[model samples]
Target: MWVTSSTATALLPTAIALGNFDGIHRGHQEVVRSIVGVDATGSEDCSIRRTVVTFNPHPREFFSGQRRQLLTPQEEKVRLLEALGIEQLVLLPFDRELATLSPQDFVEKILVRQLQAKRIGVGKDFHFGYQRQGTAEDLRAIAQNHDIEVKIVSLQACGRDRVSSSLIRQSLQEGDIPQANRLLGRPYQLAGTVVTGQQLGRTIGFPTANLQLPDNKFLPRYGVYSVRVVLEKTALLGVMNIGCRPTVNAEAKPTVEVHLLDWSGDLYEQTLTVNLEEFLRPEQKFSSLDALKAQIQTDCKRAKDLLNSQL
Candidate 1:
């Protein structure tokens, strides 16, 4: 149900949740739910398709001509949206022409004429069209001309702070895993392909799975973490390290490697998703491989204790 086109004619009348839903966090979920509802029936009268309209190449990325590290990349976002019962996702290409569309034109031409949007939902702070001049209120006033309903959902907050993608990113960057997970309404996850590594862990009787992530996947703080590894629907406990193997080679780039506790198998080329549960310690360089091995043993023990306590 991922329709990656700017011009594909929608077959059914649509109720849309519109935004660059980067994280699909609580606040984004609110906007989506406002339109799709809990059952995802869309609207009462018509058989409306539940659609989410998001820009491709994200406006920031388009403008900067650079890929931004993402909380939820396209594939993950599509999967998450489908789980929320969305029927279709329209990825509009963000380019110079789309950027120059006036607010009225954006609503009338894009939402009304093209998508046949009967209802649209957006966050209160949502902006669109012509140098980002369109506000939520503007959308409401303009959509009214086309007899379209616009729901501007209020900002969602967690305690004193607002629930936002940037706030969650900051929490992750600081290695505040609990805070980030709390805001996200789930654990912060990184999914990657299991690749071959230097086999240093194997030599020490602890084989690890090295993850190959997307070039623009956003990483949390580079540290040792208590984590849960999901493979083929089975969850396993593990100790994950997200940093350069400084003791082995200080000049190496940061890498994500995990040693699953009480689990052993060939995981080469298979996909695994790691959910960071707790940050145990910062990455530190040790004098020798033996010293690093000893620290890893402690890390695995602590990770096991933390994961078991949760269960």
Candidate 2:
């Protein structure tokens, strides 16, 4: 996908779709599909370019001090959009100035004048402009005046609930990997670097690689999980414990300690991507070191059995 920072010079006379597209969930997919469908029927090669306009730093973060964790990183979002056949991505930097633009100014300057968009697609619930005064009706009026066509994609539903990033996050937090994957159309995974620890796992018979998660990244609830760890090109089945080490009375931050089955390596500083496959048990404080070690053994056995069944 071609990525452009400046929206002024980036957009050609294109058919543009607009949204935050945080998770790029199924609902967002419908909007993009509509744009592509329109593009496919157009006769001129460059008469209409297909593009997506999204913001950086997430507009919510500016208003609210805390922001919901993102499901896909910026790079990952770009890659997924490319796979969906999006021709260009206009990444506008969100700041105070952009936030204060009037609804009419935003449409005239960015959408109509700069982009020269002949067609536009957006979700039914999408909002924009300072204080979000821009609505679907407002967009329709603007489009009508400019002779641009506007398409509104309805929300996509999975089962009874509508598919959304918030629902996906709640499912993951509840250890419902299956439900999360169902909405995401793939397993939820986290990427982190392997950092050095105090070697406590070594003393207890299971050596672990300590993981450092990215800042602002959301983690699943603290628990022991059956997971698949990808290191370099190989995928390894493992049991991962995510929590503070309560038995040792360590006041450390939450870490993902993974024990790779039948694997041994010097993985310090290397990055590992872990996919939580199933929730085995919640994190608990054991009374003694021996008791904690015993529970780990049981967890490992269960993880191995679950992985075996899948193979």
Candidate 3:
């Protein structure tokens, strides 16, 4: 999909899907699919673009003192939407002005004037406008005046629980990789550039490529994960550690280190995208180097078995 900022001028009529789309989980995907589906099943309108209108800094980040962690961040979010066949992405800035626009103004200015949307889609719980006063029904009522078709997608669920970004975050925080993956419709991933480390892993005979996760990136429970690593054109099975390495040094902060099985090469300054397939154990302090090395060997074996079974 082609990405355009909010300030860019819009010329084509669009079938737009609107939301923060934090994780772009199953529910978000369903909503997006509906937009693509509409374009597919409706009349051949060459001017109608399949577009996604998402926000930056997220809405919650503006209203609260605490910063919220993101599942897909901005770059990854774009990649995911593009993969879903969206034709256009309009990343609107979320500021005081946008936060205070009335429901009517939002519809008139964004949906009508800026996007020229012929049809729009969102999840059932979507709210917009000043003080979050608008509802799906309100959106429907307002957009109709501009001859816009509305699609309010139903809530998706995982068994009894609703499928939502918050729920997925909770799963990731709790290190429930399988649950998070189930809700996300895919494995939860962290993409970052591989940076140089202390090279302590080399002494332990398990040299690692250290990753520099993006700012405010959401991390699962601190420990070990059985992961799939994407290194340039090759995919490799790997065991990743997300911890401070207490067995080595107590003064250090947490870091992500990956030991790729059956592969060896210089990876510094390269991008490495790690998909957390399963959580193995929590980070803990060990008494001796031998104990840590023995445990790491066990972890590697367990990770290999888990990763191999999936293949």
C-alpha TM-score for every candidate = 0.95, 0.87, 0.95
RMSD of 3: 1.7
Candidate 1 lDDT trough over 10 residues, lowest sum: 37-46
- Model 3 poorest 10 in a row by lDDT: 37-46
Query: For candidate 3, lDDT tens digit of each residue in 1-311?
Result: 67777635644788888998988899999999878745534766666888899887688987895788888887898899989978788888888999999999999987888787888999999999999899999999999887788989999999988999999998988999999999999989989998989999889899999999877888889999999999888899999999788888764567989999988889999999899999999999999989999999999999999999988
Which predicted model would earn the best lDDT?
1
Q: Which stretches of candidate 2 lie over 4 Å from their true place?
A: 2-4, 9-13, 37-40, 43-50
- lDDT per model vs. reference: 0.89, 0.84, 0.88
The digit string of per-residue lDDT tens for model 1 on 147-221 reads: 888889999988888999999999999999999988888898989999988988899888999999977788999
Question: In model 1, which residue pairs have backbone atoms overlapping below 3 Å?
Answer: none
**Candidate 1 at 259: error in angstroms?**
0.8
Residue 142 alpha-carbon offset, candidate 3, angstroms: 0.9
Clashing pairs in 2: none
Badly placed stretches (over 4 Å) of model 3 are none
